[model samples]
Target: MNSVMITGCSSGFGLETARFFFEKGWHVIATMRKPDNSLFPTSDRLSILELDVTDQNSIDRAVREAGPIDVLINNAGIGYMSPFENTSDEIVHKLFDTNTFGTFNMVRAVVPQMRGRKAGTIINLSSSTTLKPLTFMSTYTASKAAVTAYTECLALELAPLGIRTVLIIPGLSPSTSFGKNAGDKISKSGEPADEYKALMEKVQSEFQREMLVQELTKPEDVVNAIWQAVTDSNCPVCLPAGPDAVALSQ
Candidate 1:
């Protein structure tokens, strides 16, 4: 049975992708910051592991324990939403650490094994905001944009090695916890205060109305995109998930 190792399976896209692969009869190594058996059904084909993508040692240890994986999905990431000026330096570092360098660390840890075996698929989750800019999401967009660019370069570099690099650009997803998490992070950082408060509110309200007109991307849409990225050898280097993403791609 082909095995896949996924990071950030605690929730959101990572959790859904883990279940999707397991249902397809693939051995799944689901890595989260905190492993919770209750989150998924018990199966011999499923193994829950603890991993912190921002930590190189954690990534290396998880990859070593996973043995040889046919696929690696870099889905563990954090989001920040605030004016670039209001976004603290610490927030920038933290966001990049998880969303950008975290991906880099995971790739570094697993690519050696994939290279030795001469085959593998690596999928990185990015955001559609990278395609069409969004207000107050500059830092988050920049981080995901980095992932998109890195994956493109990686695909070219790994082509001769028989490895595939895919980037999944998903649109705004209300079903995911990402927005809530981002809001919480912004609150903790005390953003949108003083001069930026009114502008932030206006932008957020406008964005919400825009979302209503555009079809929101579902979890299933993302899952299907990921499946295509993994199984379809002819899939494009960048696969857009959901209507907004498709629109942005065009």
Candidate 2:
């Protein structure tokens, strides 16, 4: 069976994708910051690893133990939703470290082996927030946009070596860990400045109302997109993984 390594498999898209691939009889390495046996069913085809993308030691260790991988999915990332003015430099750096540089670090770890074999697939997870801007999501959008851009350039750089790079952009998924993480980040970043309070409240109200009608992306949308990108040699370099993202992509 072809082996696949995925980051952030503890929840959301990453977890769902891992399960999807496992169901297809692929050897799956589902990694998270903290490995939990209960997260996946017992099988020789499935293995769990601990990985913190921001830490080079962790990334290197996981990749080494994962052995030869046919595909590497950089699905590990953090989200922040706060007014730019209120977003601390520490938070900004944290976002980039995990969202942008984290992807870079993982690619660095896997590419040499892939290039040697002249085969592999790299699937990166990005947010639709990069396609359509939002009021309090500047930092989050910027971080994801960097990944989207990086993946596009990588598609060009790796194609000649027979390695495929795909970008998966999905829309707001309130039911996923992304939403819970965003809220957690907001708490860490603290409240916005008083001057922006009224505007922030209005934006939040509008967003809640919009959510009632919006066709939000589900984890399955991204899971299917990754499957196609891995199985279809002629798949597009960039794929929008949900209704909202598809509309934004156009």
**Which candidate should be chosen as best, given lDDT against the real structure?**
2
Q: Relative to the true structure, how large is the alpha-carbon lDDT of every model?
A: 0.89, 0.90
- On residues 1-250, what C-alpha lDDT tens digit does candidate 1 reach at each position? 9999999898888999999999999999999887999999988899999998877888878888888899999998887777887788888887898899999999988888889989999999999999989888998999999999999999999989989999999988887777554443334566455888888889989978977787978888999999999999999999999988999999
Candidate 2 per-residue lDDT over residues 1-250, each given as its tens digit: 7999999898888999999999999999999887988989999999899998989999999999999999999998887678998888888888898899999999999999999999999999999998889999999899999999999999999999989999999888866766454443334767667989999899999988878889988888888889999999999999999889999999
Looking at model 2, report the run of 10 residues with the lowest lDDT sum.
178-187
Write down the RMSD of all candidates, one decimal each: 1.7, 1.6
